[model samples]
Structures are given as structure tokens and as C-alpha cells.
Target: MLNIDGASKRGSTAGCGGLLRNSSGIGSGASLVTWISVMPTLQSSGESLIYGLTFAYDRGFKRIVLHVDSNVVVHTLQSDRDHSVVGWRFIQEIRRLLVMNWEVQICHSYRESNACVDALANLGCDHEPGMRVYEQYPTSLSSLLLADVMGITTPKVTSL
Candidate 1:
């Protein structure tokens, strides 16, 4: 399963982070960031999705379940009807990846359900531009990772 999240300090920095667990659940992941000082929030997420898909395919994984937190990204991917040129580009690339000989399931994951990726995305901004893969996760992620395996959840608060 690939659980991912993208984040941007709108116009300053942007990054994507996710964990890809093997069939038996062993894990590896990447925190790829762009130093671009003026990227949109949506585009960063879209780019993150692209990176995630390519990483999975490169590792020769044949079955994948992609869980993402952005509803716009998820809806656009599933429907392939995005109107913006940038969005169209991202969607097109992702579509090409999906049509490969693998079985991939894409779903929308709520922010609370994706706390690890959220933290990773934030931490990702600290990385120099480019993708960094981990055989072992960063020590900072220990608690979140443990919480994931234990199914411990954090509360979500919304301002009215």
C-alpha cells in the first residue's frame, strides 16, 4: 500500500512523502521536494502523486493501493476530467501509469488517517531538492509509524 501526502508552503517550498509497504508489509519510502519558490498547493500534490506512481512501478510492484489525502487529486485521477492544463498533464501521466499491467486501487484517505505522510511531507521540506529513499525510516517517524501499526488515531479539529 502507498499512503501519501503532499505539502507546500505556497510560493516557498513544496514536497511529497509516502510509505510503500511490500506484499508482506516491509516498508520503504521517499521524501522528494522541490525548492521552487512559487508552486501551487495542488500542483505539488499532483507532482507527489507522479513521483509515487513512478517509484512503485520502478520497484516492479504489480499490485498497489494508493491512498491520498487530497480529494481534488483523487477525484481528478479517478475521473480524468480536470480542466486546467497543469492538472491535465499530471492526470495524463498518472493515467498512463495506471494502464500498465498492474492492478492499482486509488482511494481518498482523510487527513487523520494519513498522519504519518502528513508529518513526512512537512519534514520533506528540509531535504535538499530531489528524492531520498529510505531503507529504514527516519527516527522522527518512529512514533507515527508505531501509531499506524497499532491503529491509533489522532483527533481532527475543524474551525467553524
Candidate 2:
């Protein structure tokens, strides 16, 4: 499964991140994707999903479960609505990836449960230019990955 999140604050660089988890919920392969060009939150959200899916595809993953923390992205892609807007380009790319002879199950995840991705996104936001790839799980994510692997529960809080 791939869990993703995006971080964008005014006056801060925008970035997104994602991680891959095996069936047993062990995150072995993770990457920290950083976009030097700052963009809107919506765009960053799409970037995260697109990057994660592309990474999985490139790594030869046939079946993937994608977890995204943005409702707009999840709904836009799942609903199959295609609007030719600059902000929607990433959505189109995500759709393109979905049809590439692979089985993908995409869903919305609570933000609270996406601690690791959120951190990665923030790290990317503050990181210097260029991309940072992690073949193995980053040492920085040990605690978050442990909680995820151990099924440590967190409250599912949402906004109205």
C-alpha cells in the first residue's frame, strides 16, 4: 500500500511525500520527493499521488493500494471528472497511471493516520533543492514506521 500527503503553507515551500508498505504493513521502500517549485496545496496533493504511483509502477508493482489524505484528489480522480485546468494536470496524470495495466485501489485516509507522510512532506518543504530517495526506510521514520507496523491506533479526528 502507498500512503501519501502534501504540505503547503503560505510563505513556505510546497511539497508532497509518499511511502510504500507491504501487505504486512512494513515500509521498506520509501522516498522523499521534493519539488523545488512551490505550488498550490491542491497541486502538491496530486504530485504526491502521482509520484507515489509512478514510483510503484517503475518498481514493477502490479497491485497497489493508494491512500491519500486529500479528499479533493481522491474524489476528483475516482469520479473520473476531467477538467482541463492547470491545477488538474496532476489529476489527469494520476488517471493515466491508473490505466497502465495495473490494479490500483485508491482511498481516502484520515490525516491523523498519515503521520509519516505528513512529516516527509514537511521535510521536503524545508529541504534544499533536489530530490532525496530512500531505498530503505529512513532512520528518521523509525518511530512512525514502528507505530504503523505495530498497528498503534490514533484518534481519527476530522474537520467539518
Candidate 3:
């Protein structure tokens, strides 16, 4: 599944971050790509969210499970509401983009559980013109190391 989130510098954080998890296999073969964007502030709007989603889609992600802390974005995208503002043009674009064999689900997640993305976001906020990417095995020890660097506790290692 592909999970996406954003961070902003002005809001006690740096920028926006996104994580894409490839869970198409079992055990150690899983791959993940994490993306971080450094922006001036968090823009919880359709345009920014669409920008992130489109980036993932353009990169060949088919099935996506999006996680965001923005109620404005979640509600706007999930609800059947009328869009009359020009800014919401992106919302319309997002709706159109949904029909392209890509299943999109947006939900809310607590900030604490979203630490990796949070760190990426903060990194973006702290470093101007910031961007970072990690391609790794989500179930491997190195994945745990990457998670640790993000301040997330590594899961208990279990042997098969």
C-alpha cells in the first residue's frame, strides 16, 4: 500500500513527507519509497494533496492508501461536495484522476504514529530546497535502521 502525508515548516515542523510501501510480497522482499518535500508551510488544501498524489501516480503507484492529518483535505476529497472555488479545480482534477485504475482512500492518522513522514517534513522545513528519498526493504534490519534514524522505535526482531 502507498501511504502519503505532508509537513510544513511554519507549523512546528519543516515540510511535507510521504511514504510508499510496496506490500506485494511476503517477508523480506517488500520495498518502500519515502518522499519528503520542503515547503514554507503546510497547505492543507486540494492542490497540495493532489500534487503529492499525482507525483506518486506518475511514478507508477497503482493502489494507494493515503494518510493525512488534514481534515480539510480528507473531507474535501472523500465527501460528495460541490466545488465552486478556483482553488478546488485541483479537487476536480483529483476526482478525474481517481478513475485511472488507481484506488485512492484518504484517512486521518495521529501525528505521533506518523513520525517518519513528520521527520521528513521537518527536514524539508529546516533545509531550504529540501528533498530526500529512501528505497529499502521495509521488513529488513536496514529498514529498522532507517526507521530509527527517523526517531521511530524498531519493531522487535522475530526469527522465522
Candidate 4:
């Protein structure tokens, strides 16, 4: 289980993607890749996380390790109080999801290390708004997925 990523372009579109991997670091054939209409990036990010958790729960996964690229979202999940009124409902939902008996851990991940899902998220931005579930890695994302599985790091340059 991994935290899903949501990408949005200038408020025009929002997309999200997530992958589930076994302890061996190989894909577990449970992945969610899709996009929705324009929405705030934070909202999309939160929604995607919830979506992933829900899927895990429905599938009877008792242990899950989720990774997200947004520190704000991670912090919110760890905090006892909600910070954003706009995201209050989502925050509550996340808290409820966490209350289950399942053992779940959520952590932050750098975008560079999460390139595979990032590319899938970008793919969502280019397509129509809907959800697409993948039992196995999609052919379109093979290169990036392979790199992630191989633990190959690509240079990441960020502008301040």
C-alpha cells in the first residue's frame, strides 16, 4: 500500500495515481490510476489517499504502508486537530478510516522517488475524468515503473 498522488495543472485538471507493492518491492497488482475534474491540489491529494485506503479496506488488507508527497497532508493525518476548514470533512473521513483494526502507516515521500505514480498522475491529467483500476502495471507506464522497481534514481532539480 502506498499513498496516492494527485497532480493538477493551473486549476484546469486534477489527476491521481497509486500503486500497491508487496514486501519484496514488486508491484502487487493492485493499483488505482485516474483523474477527475479541476480541483485544488491539496483536495485531490487528500481524496486520493482516502481512495487508496478505502480500496485496501475493501480488499481485506490488514496491513498497509501509505506514502504521500505532500507534507501538509501527512502532518494533518498525524495531528489531533484539523487545520483547514475547507478540508475538514476529508480530515474527518481520514480519521475514521484510521480507526479501523487494520495496521496502517502513512509517511511522506519525495517526488523524485515517486516518479512512477507521478507519471501516472500526469497521464490522468491528459485524459477524461474517470477512474481506471489496473490489476497489473499498465503498458504505458512500463518505463517509469521499471525504474522504480529497479531503484534507479533520476536527477531531480527543483526551483525555489
Candidate 5:
């Protein structure tokens, strides 16, 4: 499974999300596979997990390697912590899904390593005209988005 970590920065605010694909090379130029965007914050409960499980079950993913940037979410999914909170319930649902035939594991990657995913995530929060496509992307975009999120002027990438 290919895992992507993504973040979006809006003016003085930021949001993050992840994309997981069955193909090992969605962004690496290896294989093409349908992908799913995973957002625990968006779910805030078992709703998203249940939806994901049903979709994965129908799609027949042999093994599921869960990729998550949120350490809290990852830990909760790994243990039987009886967190009855609505948010924790979703984590439990994910755990239950893990117990199925699908082999479940988690991997962590620096946000930079998952730029494509991060861009997609950013779009989810504050989509702008320039962010619609990956091709011809500008590096300055990172600074711009960060500046917007931080409510600061976009920094000059170089003094020149």
C-alpha cells in the first residue's frame, strides 16, 4: 500500500489528511490504483472507519497497511484501549477492521516525503486556483501556504 501524508494551510490555520492506495507506486510512478483519503478528524467517530471497511471489503484489499501521521490515532488503533469517546470509537472500529483477514500495520513518514498527499490535503482545507494540479507545481507554494496559515507574508525562497 502506498501511504501519503498531506497538510493544508489556510490563512492562520492548517489541516492535515492522508491518502492510502493499494498500489505501491501511486506517487512513485510505479502502479496505478484507486485511492482513498483518510481523515480521522473528518470522521470524529466510527462513521469513516465503517465506510472505509465496507469499501475495502468490497474492493478486496488482501493486506491493509494503515499509514497515519497522527501518533494518537495510530496508538489507539493498535491497542484495545476502551476509549468510549465518540472519537475513540472510530479508532476501535479501525482496530476491528485490522483483526480481519487483512494484515494491518502502520507506517510513519515525514510530511515532506508525502508531498503529493500533503498537497491534496491542503486542497481539502483551502483550495486555491494554483493547487488544482500536480504538474508544474511551484516550490514557492509551500511558503505561500505556510505564510497564509501563519498570517505572515510569503517568505522569499532566496535572497536574490
Candidate 6:
């Protein structure tokens, strides 16, 4: 299973991150985090999703279950036809990758339920523009990863 996420500050930097977990919700020790610099949040999200999928394919993963928090990105990917003008290239690339004889299922997840990758995305924003491939789990993500593996849910708070 893969949980992917993207982060951006409107007038600052942007980045994307993803985590590949096994059935037990433990990191497979293969993860991605990168800074894109100066892009809209939506673009960052789409790019991250694309990067995650491509990474999985390159690693010879034939059956993948992708979890993302952006509804727009998820909807665009699920459509058989593309109607995006801003992210046309990414949409096209994702389509091409999806047809590579793999069983890929993309699903929507709430942000709170996806804390590990979210933390990674924020970490990307603090770094220079580049990508990092990790073979071992980052120490920072240990607690959040544990929560996910234990099925712990974070309570949501809303402002009045």
C-alpha cells in the first residue's frame, strides 16, 4: 500500500512525499520525498501522486493500492477521460503509467489518517529542491507510523 501527499506554502515553496507500506502498515523501507519549489498546492499534489506511481512501477510493483487526500487529484485520475488544462501533462503521464499491466487501485483518505506522509511532505518543503529515496524508515516518522499500524485515529477539531 502507498500513502502519498503534497505540501505547499502559497508564496513560498512546495513539495511532495510518499510512503510504501506493507499489509501490516509498516514501511517497506522504500519512500520518496522531494521539494518542487514554487508551484501551486494542487500541482504539487498531482506531481507527488505521479512520482509515487512511477516510483512503484520502476521498482517492479505490479499490484499497488494508492491512498491520497486530494479529491481533485483522485477524481482526475479515476476518470477515463481527462478534462484538466492546468495539469494536463501530469494527468497524461499518470494515464500512461496506469496502463502498464498493473493492478493499481487509487483511493481517497482523510488527511488526519495520513499523518506520516504528511509529515514527510512538510519535511520536503524545508529542504532544497531535490528528491530523496530512503531505504530505511526516517526516525521522525516512527511515532506516526506506529499510530497508523495500530489503527489509531486522531480526533478532528473544527473552528466555530
TM-score of each: 0.84, 0.82, 0.65, 0.84, 0.53, 0.84
Q: TM-score rank, highest first?
A: 6, 1, 4, 2, 3, 5
Clashing pairs in model 1? none
lDDT of each: 0.74, 0.73, 0.59, 0.73, 0.47, 0.76
Model 2 C-alpha lDDT per residue in residues 4-114, reported as the tens digit of each score: 887886654677778775665563334322222224454677777777888778888899888888787777787856655776677778889999989999888888888
Query: Candidate 3 residues 53-155, lDDT tens each?
Result: 7777888888778777666666777879954575466678878877777888778766555555555555556655555665652232355335534556534
Task: Answer with 2 or 5, whichever has the higher lDDT.
Answer: 2
Poorest lDDT segment (10 consecutive residues) of candidate 3: 23-32
Better model by TM-score, 4 or 6? Answer: 6
- What CA root-mean-square deviation does each model show from the true structure? 4.3, 3.6, 7.4, 3.1, 9.3, 3.2
State residue 17's C-alpha deviation in candidate 5, in Å. 5.3
Residue-pair clash count for candidate 3: 6
By descending lDDT, how would the candidates be arranged? Answer: 6, 1, 4, 2, 3, 5
Candidate 2: worst 10 consecutive residues by lDDT? 29-38
**Backbone clashes, each candidate:** 0, 0, 6, 1, 3, 0
- lDDT winner between candidates 1 and 4: 1
- Cα lDDT of model 4 by residue, 1-160, tens digit: 5647888766767777777665666544334332222244546776777777887787777899888888998998999977879878888998899889898898888888888778777776776766666666668878887787677867778899
lDDT of 5 by residue, 37-62 (tens): 33424442243334445455556777
lDDT of 1 by residue, 62-123 (tens): 99999998787777777846656766777888899899999999999899988878877777
Candidate 6's residue-wise lDDT over 30-136, tens digit each?
A: 34332222244547777887888888887777899999998887888898877758889888888888889899998999898888888888887777777777666
